[model samples]
Structures are given as structure tokens and as C-alpha cells.
Target chain A: MSLHKKILIVILVASAGAFLWMEQQQNNFTSGTDGQSASLPHPGHSAPDFTLEQLSGEGLVQLSEAAGNANGAVVYFWTSWCPFCSASMEAVENAHRVHGETIHLIGVNVTSQDSKQAAENFLKKHSITFPNVMDQDGAVADMYYVPPVPAVFFVDSGGTITSRKTGAVTTGELEQEISRLKEAD
Target chain B: MTEPFITWSVGPFTISAQMLFIFIAAAAGYGVMSLYLKKLHVENRGEILGTFLTSLIICAVIYKLWPFILDPQLLISPGNLLYFAGGPYAVYVSAGVAVIYFFLQSIRKKWSHHSLDSFMAAITTALIVFSLGVKNYGLPSPFSFGYMYEGVMYHAVNFYYSWLFLLVLLAALILVPSSKKYARSITMLTGLVIAYGLAAPFQV
Candidate 1:
């Protein structure tokens, strides 16, 4: 066969393999309903678990422990200096106020970039009540891949990151994610 | 799973994975085309370079102007033009415009089938690299090859495209010396269409 013919055969075989694999997987899932649920896509991967001191100086808060307690956790990384973070704080605070009981909303202050006092003051001035953790070394921020301020990671009950958003988010967006988080179980 | 992609900020510019991929694709395309030209003893480097630049300019213009077209008020503030991302629509529009431009240029230059073949090979290579970089895997799939996003495994549609394109490109490159006038080009084009059709169901 010509080189062209061989290449075409390769493509065909690969495509056919994909189709067959998909079909076989589908059949396996259909045969065992529990298997389907067990194999359900674990989207977004597990959220990087971390421990940080609460900004209120109320001892260290471990992410896994907090996540275990709540239906879902919202890990928000922010710096006091960011105007966008300032703007989004109100929406986050609102979400906390409304869904604090069910959702574990933790503010991770990227303190290495900003002064701890500034972050504390920013929270106080905004009248935010949700627990705020100070990532003094920015380790947690780095782990979460938050370069820009106002990054939010919505983690499900299983500690899987259900969704994430970079930059500022609106009240609606926050609530929408919260609802999705509630249902992510 | 943490930060699957990273964007580097250099001065006022932020280079994302997508942008880097596009650059890589363009470079690869240029190199592949150059190689083909050399192989074919074609000396129309200047014309080919012109066509590439023209396509790039057209793409940029279309991307920037797309938002303004959608929201006419955006035209009032020139700086706002920079902020309005054209997204996929801009890419499609730019590609459409570029194709028309290329056709016109091809006719005007009385280009050979060799030129077209080289152009197709470059594009296919570029596309393969770009797709791999972008990681635009489509809907959730049960297949193990699927990419996991947010706890769900999605069909690696981009990977499929890249793989198929690579095969076609390799075939074309290898068969170029076999006196197969336009056969490789036709095969490549046909393969692209078939691949598109096949991948449609898997796409989101």
C-alpha cells in the first residue's frame, strides 16, 4: 500500500478504537448502574488541601477538616491591594451571610504580597464575617494557582474542585457556584 | 490537577498557554512550509511570507473589530477595543477572511500546486500543535483517554484532531518526493473534512 493509504488506515483504526472504547465503556456503565455512578467523571480534580492560621488569630484552620464539616467549601484567594478583590468582597460576604451554615467559605489572604494588617483592616472595614485565613508565605495561593487576586475555587463535599473562577465574580455568579456546589455531592 | 495551565506576565503583556501554542503553531507552519519550498525547489519565499503576514494582520483586525461590530458604542473609545475579546467568533471570521485573501493571492500569483501543498502541510502542522497546546477536549466521556476537568472525564477532541492531522501531514511529507502532484494536498483536505465529521459527535 502507498504511504497515503497506510496513513488513512492508521487514522481509521485510531478513530474506530476510540468509538469502540467509548461504546464498551458505555455498555459497562449500563450493565452496572453502581459502576456508572462510581465511574462518573470526577471533574476538576481534587482541591489542594492546606492549613493556614486564621487572620483573627483564632488558631490554624485545616482545609480538609473544614471541608469535611460543610456541604462544600469556597476557597477564595485575595489580596487587600486588589481593587477587583475589594469590589468582589461584598458579593462573597453576601454569599457567606446567606449560605454560611451549609457552605464553608474561607478567605485565603495572599498575605505575602500584602500586609496582614491591611487584610484585617480590609475585612473589618467591609464588615465581612466569614473566617479569613492568612497565607503568610503565599504557599496556599501558589498551590491554588492564584496569581491574580479574586480567584475562587468551589470544592465539593468530596474535596474535588467543582469549579473555579479567576478575577472578580458577581453575587449571581457566586450564588450559582454555591448552588452547583450544594448539588455536587 | 492544580493549575493545569499557567500564564506568564512579561511587562504589560501576559502570555497564556493558548497564546504560546499559537506562536508555536505559526513557527512550525513557517518551518514546514520553508522545508517544503526547499524540497520542491520553489523560490517564492517572499510571496509566501507576504501571504502569512497578510493572514495574521487580517486575523488581528477581525479579532479587534469583532466586539465593535457587536457593540457599536465600543468604537467610541479606542482603548476599549483592546479589552473586547473576539473569542472563537473572531477566529472563525479571521480564518474565513484569510481563506478568501489566500485564494485571491493564489490566483494573482499564478501559484503552483506545490505552493498550495506546502501551505496545507504548514497549516495542518500548525493546527496539530495548536490543538495540543489549547487542550480543547470536548464533552464528558467514559473513555479513559478523556481529560479530567472538574472531576469529569471529557473526550480529547483536540487530541483526536492533532493525531489525525499528524498522520496526514506525515503521509504528505513522506509522499512529496513520489511525484504525487496534488495527491497529498487532496488527501490532506479530504482527511480534514472526514476528521471533522467524525469528531463532531464527540465535540461539545
Candidate 2:
């Protein structure tokens, strides 16, 4: 047989084997159900209301009040220890600076697993000027069903959640969400 | 402290750190491969360019197709294919494609084993540069030299591998005698084996 013919046969057999192996792996994952919960507050639902003390200790900030006053509000749940949160804080701060007049940007510190002093240091190090409230006992995070740190929830003027994004948020992404909020108003 | 993810906004487009590093790695690999081949007095340098381009195309197709094959449900849309397809498996597939292409070229062109040595050196240089940008820190260690990933410190395994591969490339270049028969093949095989062996303990 020609060398090209042999190579073709080998390629075909190898591809077939890889396909079968991947299919089997997919089946196993699907059968195991993966343990992911479906309890997250989906978009278009009313955002759960909560009032938490500001990090600066000036006063308490209510989510419903902030959303009602502005075009919309961005409730960002974050922790000082999460590496992604630290990386994403700059983008969130930028978004606030650009759209703070029209949109209320509220950063909620998840203090259950992180120290309050560390969170204050994180804000100071980043030069974040927006209002940040401390979720001291993590009851607010549980109310929102936040799965991870650096989660951003966009809530409209009607207190309805427009969207929920988990993980790090880029400047462009935060801007896009702000634009969407403005358009909804 | 190293940032977990880096990105730059260019007008409407955003370029991630990973994409920038991959581009730099590819360019450096091609340039190094061309220089090494020229040093060995290989006249047909265009073959190296052709081989690299062909391997890239084949790797991309394999990367996109593998996920769809795994779960036909992922074939719902083009966006889904892009989102779900490529990962570590694509690197393995690309390496396999490059090897097969090189083997075929060796047979067809009657190329010397020294050409294979140059190719291996090119791969090592690319991987060394890639390791600098990739986030592959291994298990947590008590050592202070490690990097902090998410509050906890982990061994900078990728950094260690990068230095090891660089040493292998340098040894292949200096220690192997160009005039000796099968010297290039021996150096290439030995460098690869040693590098892989060193990397085995760090693999997650």
C-alpha cells in the first residue's frame, strides 16, 4: 500500500477513537448531573431588597432606593481575597466614574470569608470612590443567591433585575450593561 | 503581585493577555525556526513557513471540531462552537498535527535530521515564551518564591518549566556536534524526553 493510503487509514481510525472517547466522557458528566443549582435570581425577576451599612459608616444604603432614584443600579458583590475581584475592581471603578451620574454603582463587600480591614485596604489601594456597603453576616449575599465573588447584578428603576453576570467584569462589559440600563429607562 | 487576568481595549475591540502572548510566541517561534534552518545551510526555508501555516490551520479545525464531537448539543450555533471548543486538548492536537506534517515532509523531501532538530528548538522557544504568560501555577507550597493566585500562594511551576526548556534548547544548540551523524535527532529526542520528565511531577 502507498504511504499516503496508510496515513489516511491511521488518521481515520484515530479520529474515530477520539470521538468515541469524548462522547463517553460527555455521557458520564451528564449522568452525574454536575451538582450545579438552579436557584440563582434569573433576569426579569424582582431583585431582593436589602439595606446594609456603608463601609465609611456614614449611613445605610438601600438597593430599592438607589434603583428608584437613578436610571438603574449595579450591585457588585465582591471579596478582597478573590484574585478575580481585585483584577475586576478597576473596571468597575472606571464604569462608575463614567456612568455614575446616571447609574447608581453600589459595591457590596462579602465580609463573611474576608476581613473588613482587608476590604477597606482593597478600596483604598484601588482608589475606588464609589459607595461600598459591607455585608457583615453575608445574609445579603445569600438573599441574592450569589454563587461567586465579583458578581454584578443590573437592576432597573422598577427594582427588576435586568441581568446577572458572575465572574470578572471588564470595562467594556460594565459599560455595555450600563448602556442597556440607560436604554431601558 | 501578578494580576489574574489582563485585557486592553482598542476602540470597540478588547484584546486579552492570553491572545497577545500567543501571537508573540508564534512570531518568535517562526523567526527562530527560520534562523536555525539558515544556520544549518538549508536552502528551502519556505518549507518551514508552509509547514507552520498548514499546522496552524489543521490545529484550528481540530480545536473547533473536537468539542462538537464530544457533545452534538454544542453544535447549536457558531458562537457556541467558539465558546465551548478550544482548550488544553487543542494544544495536544496541534502538536500531533505538526509531527505528522513534519514526518511526511521528511519522507517526501529527503530532509536531513538536522531540520528536525531546528523544528524542536523552535517549539521549545515558543513554549518557553507561552509559559511566561500562561496561568498554570501548581499546588500550594510553603516556599516564599511562589505566586499568589487567589489569596493563597502556589508553586510557580510554569516558570520552572520555562527555565528548564530554555536550558534544554541551549544544550541542544551548544553540546551537539553538527558534523556527527544522527547528532540532531539524538539531541532533539533527548531534550524532549528530559523536558517532559521534568514536567511530569508538576502536571495537574
The candidate maximizing TM-score is: 1
Candidate 1 stretches greater than 4 Å from native: A1-185, B1-5, B136-157, B174-182, B199-204
| Per-candidate local distance difference test | 0.73, 0.70
Over B65-167, each residue of candidate 1 has an lDDT whose tens digit, in order, gives 7656755664565655444445324578877888678767877898777777877888898988887777654555666767775576777778777876776
TM-score of chain B of each: 0.84, 0.80
Output the TM-score of candidate 2: 0.49
Residue A183, candidate 2: C-alpha displacement in angstroms: 48
- How many steric clashes does model 1 contain? 10
Question: Per-residue alpha-carbon lDDT of model 1 for A130-182, expressed as tens digits?
Answer: 99999988877777656667788888887777776666655656777788888
TM-score of each: 0.59, 0.49
**Over 4 Å off, model 2:** A1-185, B1-5, B69-84, B148-153, B199-204
Candidate 2: residue A134 Cα off by (Å): 16
Which candidate ranks first by lDDT, i.e. highest? 1
Candidate 2 chain B, poorest ten consecutive residues by summed lDDT: B81-90
